[model samples]
Target: MPRFGSWLLAVCFFVSGGAFAGTTCPNFFIAGSAPTLDASLLSRTTEVCHTEYVLFASGVTKGPLYSAEHLTAAQIAGANSISRSGSWHQETGIPTADRSQSSDYTNSGYDRGHMTPAGDASTLTSEGETFSMANVVPQLHKLNAGEWEKIENYVRNIATQQGEVYVVTGPAFDPTTIPTIGKDNVAVPAYTWKAVYEPGVGAAAFLCTNADNYTCAVVSVDDVKTMSGVDPFPALSATMKSNPIGLTLP
Candidate 1:
């Protein structure tokens, strides 16, 4: 249990597009991590269990435009003894009550894939917080467990190796008319990408398209923009920008 009001949050997550600042989006980006997009179409913020997960709403879909988080190695290690054990719960961050619900994923075929993984929930509170719907996207089962999971595990490994890393991840919804899950019409992204920067070590990004035998695409930060129309990492220093980790397998 946090010391009453002593649970100080170190990161700030918000939604921006046009003049509306209330759009929900995740704050996975830390202080001065990236530059804000000049033109945002829609943004929304959702709050649940006294915690806020900022998510950007898409003009194309009612669900989150994306879910994000900012985490450190120590912050992730807070609950070292706990195991991965928790159920998916509802999130009220979206404007519509029905939009961000647990049932929205019921039989939707897509897994409620976590952009912010559950491995970080090492404490009672943080563990439960990891279940927030605002932190998830409708992802395929194979992709979620396979390539995406590999990427997440690799980042965790980096956290253990170098100490800390900044991560921002979510879906890249294709502009063409696409399939949506549940009644809320949450658009299914053709691909999903995660942009990571390990301060002293190195940084790189990759994307996993949803499919059976999915092969991921290792690309640059600018390449991510061509897919998702957003700059997750803005104003990067020379090292991280120039030194991207290659997607080499073991």
Candidate 2:
């Protein structure tokens, strides 16, 4: 809890080679700080065995603390071609009722949206791992399929073009506003937040509110931190953030 979350990083991440450039899960270089974790929050880190990132699940929201990843150009180029594993399932120990499952949204009108999108995974194994229920949240269908998905693609494209990118993203909610979807009580977030970081280029974010037209606006990382309560990249303030193309999407 020394700022961004060095303790959680040590506890949750285990060093690995290759695309990660020798780092563990819950990478903090992108955030410029490790979250100051709260024991009372009862959050726990669970490695999504199928992908290269990690999940920090919230006991209250019963959703991802935020899913994180480091993506390289080579991986991004191949990520689009891989098919989804369709392997959504619950984590061990967490009560099934507090967890989100694929079945929970069968007819619930929301999308079983991925916090760490399948398209962000570079390999078949990693791509498939993204399907784990730990990486999902009950997202608004249009937001999930359109704006949110567009953000994912845009991040990957930029990362590939400018070396590698580190990202952390997830949903936002109000304690009194959880719209529980299934019998399991998987919560629907009021907003979805995403932060992206490139070492030299700096950090940026998006706040996609759950709505009819979910086109999100490019935001300051500080704005995302204030709203999400998770600072993925602390150094990314409005003045330092950049949108090279100045483009907005549907």
Candidate 3:
């Protein structure tokens, strides 16, 4: 595991404010790397999304930490849906490329599917803001709107029960990546994970994938203890943290 100092350093870089051209998340850390965009062009943007996951620059459609594939700023800006506006669309537009090449896999398919659903953020606008594309990924519709959605709701319940919680979610990047979209435009994912932290309450994370029949294995984060019958996502040496500002739930 990474020492606390190293973890702190990584977190500092993310919330440093200036590192991302006046954009910052309370406590930021790299979830994973995908395709990248032009830093120069992104640096010009002042738009910032307040989310536990990705953060963005003013003019940049995505955050510096994310990698964009075939998506463009114009497409992202124009593709907004009434279903996702106001506080609900804050950190929504995290740039991601449609490497899937599915004809139906336009930027809209990659709509900022809430890892932490809008219901969780009913208390604050920042929670709604976190729903923008800057915080989304090219998720399969079934997973995004199905089992994964249930898990998000569960986490929200946990947060409400616990008073406050820290949740970090993102894609798992690897060489043998899952086929994002089939030739027919069907979307897919090899696996996905959501890590939840509640400081003194209790910490746990869950890993699920299409390959696993979408059954989630919830593991305790308080200790390194593993859960039986549950598969673990690739473990990171460092513990990921996010800024907790603007996250107060009603």
Candidate 4:
């Protein structure tokens, strides 16, 4: 848990409309290892829309994710960008569903996706922060609102069972440059990537999407050494070692 002072500072900043000072998003250090995140840049006062469980940044949005006070943006740039939301003590900004809208706009064709998935925001406060608009992106409505959301929930449940889980998520764009929707309002992506680490078993999993589709690369804690590509494994510390299992794709 983080110190109470940090929580207080976050709340004050959130309420007072302060902004995050750094261009880089925060990193998650677990088991003596620090991993990077990928997401869009953060923006202030942008219009956020929820079409089920997935939250996306639409009109005139800047940055990757936003909280009440701060904006979360990426650090490294390429096919992917990393962003962080949430902390140790306070569970302030986990994005919620817009129940007022009909499930018609949320379910069926759409994937119950998460702008900031559960494993990524492993901590209570971190998970809460993920709920903010700055942290969300356009996800497959069905996946975002359904099975995908379930996967995130399951990860959280497993984390609680094991102890804690550290997660990192970001999109893998095709051109590397951020893509914009055309007049037709079609959302296109280059690619997407997600990684998860469970300290309880020293297990890890990485998933990648090239054309809005999900594929799982189940590697043992040791096998991670062999994986490489456009988005290589962010680098793990000596203290982190263990293979992950039970991962499913949508």
How well does each candidate superpose onto the true structure, as a TM-score? 0.76, 0.77, 0.47, 0.44
Task: List RMSD in Å for every model shown.
Answer: 10.1, 8.5, 12.4, 15.2
- The digit string of per-residue lDDT tens for model 3 on 30-92 reads 232221222333343433434333433222222222311111223222322224444323232
What is the TM-score of candidate 3?
0.47
In candidate 3, position 23 carries an lDDT of 26
Candidate 4 lDDT score at position 77: 17
Worst 10 residues of 4 by lDDT: 70-79
Greater TM-score among 1 and 4 belongs to 1
User: Where does model 2 exceed 4 Å of error?
Assistant: 1-33, 37-51, 93-98, 235-250
Instruction: Pick the TM-score winner.
Output: 2
lDDT of 1 by residue, 1-250 (tens): 1211111111011223323233223345555433244254344433232232234444345454444455566755764667777677655444554356677788988898887677755576676776776667788899888878888777777766667667767676654446887766676777787877766555667767766676686666555544565556664654555456764431
**C-alpha positional error of residue 83 in candidate 1 after TM-score superposition, expressed in Å:** 1.9
- Name the best candidate (by lDDT): 2
| Whole-model lDDT, model 1 | 0.59
Error of 1 at 79 (Å): 4.4
lDDT of each: 0.59, 0.64, 0.37, 0.35
Q: What 10-residue stretch in candidate 1 is worst by lDDT?
A: 4-13
